[model samples]
Structure formats: C-alpha cells, structure tokens
Target: MRTRGALSASGASVLLLALLVLVPIVVLLAAWQQEQWATWQHLLDTVLWRLVGNTLFLMVGVTAGVLLLGVSLAWCVATLEFPGRRWLQWALLLPMAMPAYVLAFVMVDLLDYAGPIQTFLRQWLPVLPDFSARHPLWVVITLSLVLYPYVYMLARLAFEAQGRAVLEQARILGDTASSAFFRVALPMARPGIAAGLALALMETLADFGAVSIFNFDTFTTAIYKSWYGLFNLQAAAQLASLLLLFVVVALWLERRGRSRARYSEIGGRQTLRSRPRLAWGVTLFAFAVLFLAFLLPVSRLLYWVIDNGLMQVDARFLNLIWRTFLLGTMAAVLVLTLAGWLAWVKRHQPSPSVSVAVRLATLGYALPGSVLAVGIMISFSAVESWLADLGVGIVLVSTLAALLLAYVVRFMAVGFGPVENALQQVRPSLVEAARTLGASSAEVGRRVYVPMMLPGLLTALLLVGIDVMKEMPATLLLRPFGWDTLAVRIYELTAEGEWQRAAAPALTLVLLGLIPVMVLTRRRSARLS
Candidate 1:
C-alpha cells in the first residue's frame, strides 16, 4: 500500500511538471481562437504566400548547401589522408561556435560598398564604376559556413564508425576506390547523414537573425513582422501554424528515412579504415574548399576584432559575461531535468496517448520566438486576470519565470536528444537484472538508468546551454524589460550599425559555445579511438 502510494505520487509529480511545461502552448492555442482569427485571415491574403515561398526556397537552398559542404568535408577528413587532416577534423566544427547572424554581420562588414572587399577592388581595378548588387546568394553562403558543421560532425562520426573490412572486401571484389565509396561507404553513412540533415533543416527553418538581416523574408521573419509591425498576433499565429505543418512534414520524412536506414555494421572484424591518398590536384581542391568554407569568414571576424580595437578586457563587460554564463547554465540545468523526466516516461511507460502528448509538447521548438512570445503573453494575461478575479495581485508577464518557460519550450529537444540517445545505449538487461533482484521500477531507474545516462544528460545540457546563449528572437521578445542577455545586446548593437560594440559580446558567445564543442569532440575522439 505504501509502495503504491509512492509510485502514484511520483507519477503525479511527473504529470504536473509536464502540464506546467505545456501551459503556454495551451494558452496560445486557446487565445488564438478567441479574438485574432480575422486579422490572421487578412494577413494570410496579403503577405502569407510570399513569405511561404521565400521560406521554402531558403530552407531548400540552405539544406542542400549544408549537406554538400558538411558531407564532403567529413568524407575528406575521415577517408582521405592529408597534411592537416587531424587538425581539420576538429577545426571544421569551429564554425558552429559562430552564430549565423554574427557571420552575416561579418560578411556585410567585409562586402558592403564601403567595406573591405569593395575598397580593395576599387584600389586595384580603379576603373569599374561603383557596382552594387543585392546578392541573396551571400546570405546562403554565410549561413552554410556556420551551419554545415552540424552535418559535418554527424557524417564524420558515421564515417569513423565504418570499419575497414567492408571497404577492403569491396576493393578485393574489383571495386576501385571511387566506386567503393559510392556503392559501399556512402550508403552505409546514410543514417548519420540524414540525422545531420534533419538538424540542419530545423536550424534553417527556425533561423531569425540570418534571414532577418539578409532581408530574405522567411516564415520566421514574417511571424515577427506580423506581430510587431502590424501588431497582428492572430496573423502571426496562423503563419506559425503553417510553418509548423511544413516542419512536421520535413520531420516525418527524416524519421521515415531513418527508420529505413540500416547503417550500423552489426558483426564484423572491425579495423580502422586506411585513409585514401589525395592527388596533388585533389589536395589543392580540398585546400580551396576549406579556405572558402571555414577560413575566410573566421579570418574576417578576427581582423575586425583586431582592426577596430573592440576586444574589451573590462569589469563591466566581464559582468555581462558572467550573467550570460549564469543564465545559460541555470536554464540548461532546468531544461535537462524536465527533458530527462519526460524522456524516461516515454521510454519506460509509453502509451499511444503519452507519445502523442510528448510530441505535441515538443512542438514549441518549431514555433517562432515571436509566436511563442504572443502565446506566453496570452497565457500570462489570463493568469493575471484570474488572480485579480480572486482578489489577489500577481504580475506574471515580463518576469524571469516567463523567460525561463520560453527557453524551456524552445530548447527542450536539445536536452531530450542526448538523454534519450544515452538511455538507448544502456542494455535493457541491466534494468531487468535490477528488477529481478527485487528492485522496483523506480529503483531500477534511479540506480541503473540515471547513472549510465549522466554523460548524455550533460551533453544535452551543453547543447541547450549553447543554444540558449545564442538565441535572439525569443530572448528579445520575452526577456524582462531592462534585462539584456548577451545575444540581445549583440543584436541591438548590430541593428544600430555599431558593429564594434556587437563584436565583443558576439565573440564572448562564440567562445562559450566553443568550450562545449571542444569537450564533446575530445570525448567523442577518445571513445572512437
């Protein structure tokens, strides 16, 4: 009787946490049907189609570019022997530390009319008239540079896991290196590649900074414009609904592809694959690719930081850095805790209703920051009204609570993935052994599951921490009045054309992001080797 009570209490606690996490989404959907449908219909008639087209085009373009750059680079680093292959393997991931908006700012600073590239061109050519072109292509290129690392990391892991025996067998069967790679290696790496591609697509869809600055109208930007520009929350919600549908489709495709994938080599004499020698011509091509993809944008940021004397080693700036660190760390811990609990339930006690509910809860990740902000506003407003009706005074909107909830909603997936992946790796027999030894399910989970899943939980925390630190649109909208995160500060400065001031915080966020990437890479390398 006591055990049953305890189990019931535990289940209730889990359910309550899940409900709190879902409150804003529930409020948003309820409020949308209450008063905003008409304005949404109007906006849908006017600007919705254009926004949809631009967003779809950008998503497709960025997805293709990231996959190409990421997979090719992974292939080169993993399978081809080169002079700096070892360094390149890790260095390639550095771009991910740099946010898309920061890269966009760097590109604009370098390629604008009065910027370095044009000035250099004028100095050399001296005769070409001042040429100006609104190149959307540059946005695609800059975004790819920063985002391809997602694909690269996954694909490289896939390649590294592909043992030499399979490739050697193919070679012995009269297959040349190129043919072997095409027929055997690439097919085997599909799962990892697809996973990477799914991540890339998600980032591309959720992007606000890069698309906003580049003046390329995507669904995210449209959501922002509708909410802030026209004060049309309903319209924004409608657009968000559409965007959500698109994301659902993409995710479905990715899941389908993943289900069909049979990339894991289950039984084989595993040996490290020998690196293929690069011909001189191919080596030069590889260098050029690396230079254009990874080196140039980074070099630009370094130059601007040095040339403008923007590197601040001051106390006030240090305080901002500390605050940013605290916020990110706390948010990561909170998100991980909630995500771990939810994942645990999904894995152990999943039913159709629970699975559907979990999926619906995670949809917050796909909603635009502006849409989420509006949802939060609607929810908080209702709460405040309820408090007033009960003769109690409470302010809910524009508080730390609201901001944290938004962060949780936006980044739960980051924390969830690592924990789930970690849990999957632990053999089910370990838990079964504990159960057979007279341990309850709760005890088995607490003892056998949590300990083994700590690394994955930590990884998830790191991923969410980095994402929250770099997050802008959501932070900008939902942050308490006068409370500025590093991302918010950077975006404000850059928007005002104060690139020098922006560079400091931008650099700080990048450095913070790099720490986790370095840790993850080291741990991954150690395990693989």
Candidate 2:
C-alpha cells in the first residue's frame, strides 16, 4: 500500500509537469494550424529553398569551426602540460560570456572600412581594400570564436573523464601521439563533442542578432524581416517552421550520435595525464587562437567603455540595466523552478509518456528566438481576442508577461539539462529511504532532493540568467513599447553605429556569462585533478 502510494505521488507530479510544459506548445501548434498553412505553402513556392540553404551553410560552417577549435583546445589543455595550461583551461570558456551578436559588433568594428585594423593596414600597405566589403567570411570566423566554447567545455569534460590510462595504453601499443588522439581519444570523446556541436548548431540557427548585423540572410534574420519589416506574421511563421524542421534534424542527429557513442567508465583510480611541452610553433599556434578568439574582441569592448566618458552614460542606459537585471532574475528563477520539476519527473517517474513530454518541452530551446517570438505573438493574440469576446480585459502581447514566457520557452532546457544531470546522480535508494521514513512525496522532495540538488539548481539559474541577459529576438519582439533590456539597448546602439555606447551593456552580459563558466570549469577541474 505504501509503495503504491509513492508511485501514485510520483505519477501526479509528472502529470503536473507535463501539463505546464505542454501548454505553450499546444497553443503554438493550434495557432499554426489556424493561420500558417497557407503562408507555409507560399514559402514552399518562393524563398524556402534559399532560406534552407543559407541556414544549412551557416550551421555547417559554425559546427565545423567549433569542433576543430574546441577539440584542439580541449586536447591541449587536458593531455598536454603547458605554461598557461591551468589558466587556459578556464580562459577558453570566457568567450561564451560574449554573445555572438556582440562579437559581431566587435568584429565589424575591427574589420570594417572605418575600423582601426583596416585603418592601420591602409596606412601601412595602402593597397588593402575595405575588409568587410571584400570579405564576408569574417562573419563566420567571428561567430565561431564566440560560440566555440560550447564545444570546448563539452570536449574538455569528455577528455577529463577518459583519464590517462586509455591514452597511455594506446601509446604503449606503439601508436603515435597524433594517431592515438585521432583513433582513440577523439573517438572516445565523440559523444561529448557531438553534444557540444549540437548546442553550437542550435545556437547558430537561433542566432538573429549576429547574422542580421552581418547582413546575412539566414532563416532567423529573414523571419524577423518578414514579420516586422513586412508585417506578415504568417510568412514569418512559415520561415520559422522551416527553421524548426532544420532544428529537428539537428536534434535527431544529436540523439543518434549520443546513442551510438556511449562511453563507460572503467573501474579504476585515475591520474591526470601529463601534457607534452608545446614547441615554439605549437606555442605560437595556441597563442594565436587565444589572441584572435578572446583578446581582440574583449580589448575592443574595454577600449570603447574606457574611451567613452562616464558622462556619456545616460539615465536610459541605467534604467535598461536595472530592467534587464530584474527580468533576467525573474526569468531565471521561473526556468530553474520548472526545470527542477521536469527533472524530478524524468528521474522518478521513468514512464514513456512522461519522458516524451519532457523532451518535447525542451524542443523550445532549439526554436529560434524570432520563431518562438512569432509563436508567442500568434498565441497571445488568439488568447487576447478570445478574452475580449468574453468581456475580459487581458493583453499579453508587448508585455513583460510575454517576454518572460518566451524566455522560459527558449531557455528552459538550459536549466533542465544541468538539473536533470544532477538529479540523475542522486541515489534512488536515498529517495526510497526518505519515503520509507513516513515522509510524503513532497516532503521527501523538499528535504532529500532539494538540498542535494541545490548546486545544480544554482548552476541552472546562472546559465539561464546569462542567456536571458544576452537574449535578443524574443525580447525585441515581446518587450513593451518604452521598455528596454540591456540586450535591446545594445542592439539599438550598435544598429545606429554607436558601438561605444553599446559597450557597457555588452560588457555586463559578458561578465555575467563568465561567472557560470568559471564555476563549472573549476568544478570540473577539481574533479579531474
């Protein structure tokens, strides 16, 4: 009877989570059926192919670049002893703090005709043409720099987990260092690398700010243009739907990759692998990666912030910062709470239906912010119209309510992943013992689970907070008129060619993003060491 009651309680909690997570998706799907079939048909006939191609190109480019740079850096830090190995391990993750869009701004500032890099080159060479006009490849390079850390962290974890025994065995078997890395270490780390690449690709597809500012024609940017630029929500939704299809493919690939590349821990104590000392050429190469990827963009932002006097910072800027903080904090709290619930359900219930619902809820993370913003608009419009007809006065569009909802939708997975991971590590017997002690399900959760999961919950909060602060399209579309967040302010300033004015907000976002990365990296390092 007690066992049955525990199971019943678990089922109920799972059901509650399923309902909360499914609501927005059902609303969005219903709204799509109601309005978007025709527009989707039109897109199929017109620009769909081009949008697909552009999105694919960017995805492929970004994924490949991130994998190469991220894996290399991880390998160097994990297996090779170097001068700055300790610092570089943590420093590699710093780029994640800088959003792709802000990096886009910095890249444009440095590479554009009027930027200092070009100015210096013109003075020296005099034959160098404008870089931006002459080369669009820089956009891809810039984006990869900011986004590669996703892959780096994952690959590093994989490498660390593999320990030194496997690699040493490969070496003893007469394999060269390069051969061992390629044949053994790389293959062993494939799952982690794939996970990271999937994240990077999802981020690439969802990117609107960077691609838009670079004058790129990816689906996300195009979706925004269709909606706000042309006043055609249906057309935008259609583009978004196409983007959603691509995201589905990426998610499927990630799932398949993980399933096939499973790694098992060997039952033995492990030691940290000593790294080979970097030769002169290799040292230069590592320095170059750090210089271009981290130093350049950060220096530009710092320069702008310092060059622009404090007097130039206005009341509006301060207000935006405060607003960003409040909204981001609120959204983070909500996301982490819901994520904890979902994670608990997944861990305790272990039913097919519950698992499917949790996975579906996380699908929102893959949807482009513009696409999700459009979905929110359509769904909110329908709700408001229905409420108005019922003589109720409720408006969700252009309000903080809509913004928070969108943030939750887009970033819930960020919180969910860490909490789910943490929860999985908790022994099932611990929960059973709590229940056997005559505690109710809720009580067990409060006492046993919540206390144990605090670190993960905090990690989730930090991840979601940083993501919300740097979030762009959803905030742009959903924010109330006369209300602004730091991200929006930065976008506006950068859009107007006022890069210096955008520096403060951009710096704040980078600083916030760095905190979580530092915490996670330190934790991982401690575990490995």
Candidate 3:
C-alpha cells in the first residue's frame, strides 16, 4: 500500500507538470478568440510577408552555413590525423559558450565601418566599399559561427562511431577518399546530421537576441514588438502561435530523424591517416574556426573590459550578479526536483500515458523563450481574472512565481535527460533486492536511487543553472521590478548600442556557459577512454 501511495504521488506530480506545459500552449492558441483586426491588418499590410521572407531566408542561409562548417569540420576532427587533433576537437566546442547575441554585438562592434577592422582596411585600400554589419548575410554568419557546434558535436560522433570500418570497406571497393566520404560516410551519418541541423534551425527560429541586435526581423522579434512596442498582447499571442508551428515542425523532424538514426551507430575510434603537410593544413583550418568564432570575439570583449576599467562593476553590477545567481539557483532546484520525480515515476509505472506526459513536459525546451514568456503571462493573468470573478484575489503575473514557471517550462528537459539516464544506470538487481528487503518505493528511492543518482543530479543542476542565467527572452519579459539578470543587462545595453558597457555581463555569461561545455567535453572524453 505504501509503494502504491508513492507511485500515485509520483504519477500525480507528472500529470501536474504535463498540465503546466499545456496551459501556455492552450492559452496561446485560444488567444485567437479575441479579434484584433486593426493589429492584424497592420501586420498583414506591412511587415508580415517581410518577416516570413527574412525568416525563411535566414533559416536557409543558416542551414547551408552550418552544414558546410559543421560537416566539414566534423569530418576533419573525427576522421583525420592532425597535429592538434585532440585539442582542436575540444576547442571547436568553445564557441558554444558564446551566445549568438554576444557574438552578434561583438562582431558588429569590430567589423562595422567605424569599428577597427574596416578602419584599418580603409587606411590601406581607399577604394574599400562601406559594408553594413546589419546585413542579413552577416546575421546568418554570426549565428552560424555560434550555432554550428551543435551540428559538429553530433556529426563527429556519428562519423567517429562508424567512419573507420566503413571507409576501409569503401576503399577496398575502389572508392577514392573523397568519393568514399560522399558515398559511404555521408549517407550513414545523414540522420545524425539531420538531427543536428534540426536543432540549429530550431534555435535559429527561436532566436530573438541575435536577430534583434542585427536589426533583423523574425517572428520572435515581431512578437516582442507587438507586445511591448505596439502594446497589443493579442498580436503577440497570435505571432507566438505562428512561431510555435515552426517549432513543432522542427521538433518533429528532429525526433523522426533520430528514430531513423537509432541503428546507425557502430563502434570504432580508429582515425584515418594523413600526410604531415595535410595534417598541418587541417590543424590550421581548425584553429582558424576556433579563432574567428571564439577567440576573436572574446578578445574584443576583454579589450572592452580593460579599456573601460571597473566602472561597470559597481553596486548595481554586484546586485545583478546576485539576482542572476539566486534566480538560477531557485530555478535549478525546482527543475531538478520535478525532473527527479518524472524519472522516478517513469521507472516505476512505465506506461504509454506516462511517456506521453513526460514528452509534453519536456517540449518546453524547444519553445522559444519569447513564446513561453508571452504564453505563460497570458495564462496566469486569465487565471487571476477568473479567481477574481469568484471573489478571490491573487496575483501571479509579474511575480517570481510566474518567472520561475517560465524557467521550469524552458529547462525541464535539460535536467530530465541526465536524471533519466542516471536512473537507467541503476542496477536492476539492486532494485529487486530493495523490494525483497521490504522497502517502499519512496524508501528505495531515498535510499538507493538518490544516492546513486547524485552525480547526474549535480550535472543537471549545473547545466540548468547556467542555462537559466543565459536565458534572456523569458527573463527579460517576465522579470519583476529591479530583477535584472546578466542576460537582461546585456540585452538592455546592446539594445541602446552600448556594446562596451554590455561587455562585462556578456563576458560573465560566457564564463558561466563554459562550465557546461567543459563538463560535456570531460564526460565525453571519459566515455571514450
């Protein structure tokens, strides 16, 4: 009976989480019930088509750029013998530490006509044409540079897993190295590559910061403008609903691609041999990517910090750091608790409905932070109104409760992956022994599972904490008065073209983000070893 009670509790928790995820989505969809014909007409008459076109164009450009950069680099790092193969492989991932918007502002600062690069160029070549940093092409390039690591990491794994044995077979069948890659390796790695591409594209679709920094308009930006600029919540909701459609499609493609790729991984780590000259060339290529994507932008940020001195790190700055850390901590704990409960319930109950519920709960990660911020606010405001009509008064909107809900919705999946994997690692015999010893499900969890899952739990905590700190759109929109985080600070500064002032917060976020990247690399290295 005790075990059944524990199971019931866990199941109830899962249902509640599922409901939380559904509320925002349902609210966004139901927003159509209110007719804002004027706003709709203005959007349609002016910027709707342009938004669609620019969005599609950015997606296409980013797709091409990431594929080329991600696939080629993955191929080199995974298959080739290089001078710094080991270090280059890891260094390539450092770009992931820099958010697209951070890179956006840095690039715009450095490469703008008035910035250092063009200024230096004009001194030598007087005929140099004026280049605009806000060009759509530059926006794509900036995003690609930061986002390609998603593809590189996944594609490299796919290649490293199956490249050696298959490539040898292709060689024996009279295939040249180039032809073998095209014919044998590329096809086999397609599903993984597709999965990674889907992720990059989803991020591209959801991006608000980079596009906004570049003065580029997409659905996310449109949604923001509608809400804060136009003062039309209905218009924002309608835009969010449309953006959610794109996210759903991207999510479906990722899952479908993963399903097909399930059997593609075959184990081997042997690398292809390369000549000394070619190896150095590969080293140079990898270094160039690392330099441009990470090193250059970071160097520029550091320069700004040094040039500006300690002016930015005053009392207000300390408070920003404190609030950011506190919020991250609160959100991390909440997400970890819920993720643990979901994992435990899945382990014990194991039903199709439970699986679906878990899926729904985690889907929040794919929804743009902007979409979630708007949807959640609308949902809670409606709840407050309904309660008021019942002679009950309460406030949720603009509260820490609302902000934390957005954080949970956005990051539950980040914590769940680690915790679920940890649960699976627990030996089945140990679980059965606990049952034989007459422990209830709750006791077994507290005694056996929690202790064993500590490492995964810690990992989840760090990951979710860092992610929440880096999160901008939700926190920016939902934060209560004086609740500015590092992300929000950077966004505010960059919005007003204060790139130098924004450097300190952007650098702080980059440093914090590195914690997860280092953790991931170390974990991957340990697995390989």
Compare the candidates by TM-score and give the number of the best one.
Answer: 3
Highest-scoring model, lDDT: 3
TM-score for each predicted model, relative to the true structure: 0.85, 0.89, 0.95
Query: Ranking under lDDT, best-scoring first?
Result: 3, 2, 1
> Model 1: per-residue lDDT, tens digit, 320-436?
677677778889999988887777777766566557656655656655566567677667877899999999999998888888888888887778778878988778788778878
lDDT scores in order: 0.75, 0.79, 0.89
Query: What would you estimate as the lDDT of candidate 3?
Result: 0.89
Instruction: List residue ranges in candidate 3 displaced over 4 A.
Output: 1-9, 310-312, 434-447
Measured by TM-score, how close is model 3 to the native structure?
A: 0.95
Better of 1 and 3 by TM-score: 3
Off by over 4 Å in 2: 1-50, 172-174, 266-280, 424-450
Q: How many backbone clashes does candidate 3 have?
A: 0
Which residues of candidate 1, in runs, are more than 4 Å off?
1-9, 12-46, 126-134, 168-180, 266-295, 310-316, 343-364, 420-454
Candidate 2 residues 147-245, lDDT tens each? 888888888878877878887889999999899999998988889988888888888888888877777778887788788887887667656766777
Sort the predicted structures by TM-score, highest score first.
3, 2, 1
How many angstroms is residue 167 displaced in model 3 relative to the true structure, after the best TM-score fit?
1.1
**Candidate that beats the other on lDDT, 1 or 3, i.e. the better one:** 3
Model 3 poorest ten-residue lDDT run: 258-267
